[model samples]
Target: MSIDTLARTSRAKRKISARRWLVPYVFLSPAGLLFVVFLAIPIIYAIYLSFRGMHVSGGGPFGVREETWVGFDNYIRTFTDAEFFAGFGRLAIYGVIAVPVTLGLALLFALLLDLPRVRAARFSRIAIFVPYAVPGVIASLLWGFLYLPSTSPLNWILNQLGFADLEVLTGGALFPAVANIAIWSGVGFNMIIIYTSLRGIPNELHEAARIDGASEWQIAWRIKIPLVAPALVLTGLFSLIGTLQLYGEPTTLRPMTNEISQTWVPLMKITRDAFARDDLSLAAASSVVLAIGTLVVSVVLLRMTQKKAFGDGS
Candidate 1:
């Protein structure tokens, strides 16, 4: 080719490449900038604050303000504090009860909705999902009232059945009560996600299985479940994270029940540190620890599930 023609072609190719790069950046800039500013910056700041502690002057009397950095002191305090550790233990228990029950119900509802003979699927889906539209605070409030002995429908039903002295929000019942709230608030959205994925499976696959003399149960167990593994993994991860950071339901229900404490969950403890006691450094440290814990748990669970779903050979 002629030099002039080659030069022109090279310049045109460069322009096209530039446009390709520019187009992606233009499309991505808003989300990228928001993530950096809001998510990345706060996470970095929290990590920085986690390693430091503050000081106060003038006997640290009311309204007196002073601050200094004490490296690793705040984290040490968090690790050594009995209340902090207890709160973490409580959250672990809450997660154990909440995550599996919620995800199991979600999966069941999703599968039921996918069934061909299921009636009122649209209404059932909307009814199931309507709870998700309610704010966590409001849902907790509603459930709190429902747990009250004086006004609760469950209490009324028990009374009608000639039973006395029922307390849903007390003792061992508190665990299931809290778990139920979490499940009620979470299941519908997860059900929708799973149902969407279930719907995506081509009907031809099911037909092929049937042609191979597979029963409906076999089709579901061997084909549908395997195909929908990704969606289940996603829902499970989200449920795990939510279980770890449980705050709103317990916090809202605290005023109504003596069973819940101010530091019932890790996030609640962090809030108490930051605002109630004005221990911002300790709060920041706790926040960082919780965030890191969440990341670690999520990574481990994802890896384990991925191996199970896809096989280690992959």
Candidate 2:
């Protein structure tokens, strides 16, 4: 080939390569920039704030809160606070009960709805999901009334049946009561996810199982469950994180009962520190710690489940 022709061909190839890479990047730049600005920047700022303290000198509305770096002072204070540790202990209990029960019920409902002969599937699905659509504050208020002795239908029913001293939001019962609310509000959404995953599964897999004389239970256990493992992981991860951040329902229900303290959950404690006490540094530290704990626990749970689901048993 002539030198001029070779040079022209190389330049054309380079131009095509540049455009090939450039188009996807051009398309991706908007989303990438949004994430960096909205998500990444805020997270970085929170971490920065966590390692610093604030000082305010001037009086009245003209006062200034000066942020001063203090290394791990805020984190040290957070770790030493008894109330802070107590929140985690409470959350651990809530998580243990809520995560399994919520996910199990979600899985069960999804399975039942997926069944061929289930009656009123549409109605049942909507009824279950309706609770999830209710605003969190409203759901808490409604459930709060039901938990109250004066307005409780269950209390009235139990009274008619000659029973007493059973309150849903008292002492040890409070944990489960809160868990029930969380479960009710979350189960429908999880069920929908699991159900969608179930529906996406090809029918051929089920037909092959039936030809091998597998019962519905066997098919669900051996085939459907493993195939939908990824969806389950995603649901479980969300549940785990949500359980850790248990705040809104408890906070809303707090006025209804004395059992729920202001710092009932980790998120609540952080909010209290940031707003109620005006300790933004401690709040930031608490937030960073909570973020770390959430990440570590979630990643660990997913890893263990993934290994069991797909790893070589040998």
Candidate 3:
């Protein structure tokens, strides 16, 4: 080849190589930086803190404090503690009630919204999704007052029906009460996600099913539900994670009722350990356990669902 042609081809290859490397880095930089700063740094710090115990020598403000490495003592203590185990049990029960109910309702709503005969679908969809915009803390506070016997409309209705006292925030009712708030707040978002995925599905499939004499129910069950399984899995995972990390609703309702203890949930227990009791090592250990538990549950659920839905290991 001529020198001029060779030089031109060399320059072209250099430009292509530079673009190939630079484009991905440019696109990934924001997320990479965020993951490092927000997630990686805090997790590393917590892991470091979990391994060390604080020592306070002598008394008063002049006491010297030191962080001494204690190996797996914090983790051992956390696993042995009855309070931590009880908290995990409670959260598991809560998740059992909340995640399925929320995801089921979301799927139902999404399917209903996708139907052609549903009137005012636009308005209804927007109205249902409005709760997602409300902060969890604020939602809990509002529902907390509404759950009170003296202030709740349900209590008034019960009083008129010859029962003078009805408390939704009490024992037995407390689980459903907490689950209701989570469902109400989360259902809208999940519904929207499922509905968006449903909309992406081709109308031809439904039309062909209809032509084949399939009923709406059959088509929904056999076609739409199967098609949107991935979205359902996504929503279920999100709900499961949120349920495992539940804190706001129970914590907010604590002042109003005696039902919720200091360690009502795992996160609440961690907060109490870290701040209320000033046991940072225990708190860090509990936090690590919580993170690991969440990770395990998410992975297990995803794998199970993927196997069932796609019939292949994910």
Which residue pairs show backbone clashes in model 2? Answer: none
Candidate 2 per-residue lDDT, tens place, 127-193, comes to 8888899988888999999999989998999999999936888888898988889899999999999
What is each predicted model's overall lDDT from 0 to 1?
Answer: 0.88, 0.89, 0.92
TM-score of each: 0.91, 0.86, 0.94
| Number of the top-ranking candidate, with TM-score as the measure | 3
Residues 78-176 of candidate 1: C-alpha lDDT, one tens digit per residue: 888888889888877888898888888998898888876799999999999999899999999899889889879888988899999478889988988
Off by over 4 Å in 2: 1-20, 55-66, 158-166, 311-314
The collision pairs in model 1 are none
Task: Name the top lDDT candidate.
Answer: 3
Q: Residue 216 error for model 3, in Å?
A: 0.5
RMSD of 1: 2.5
Candidate structures ordered by TM-score, highest first: 3, 1, 2
Q: How many residue pairs clash in each candidate at the backbone level? A: 0, 0, 0
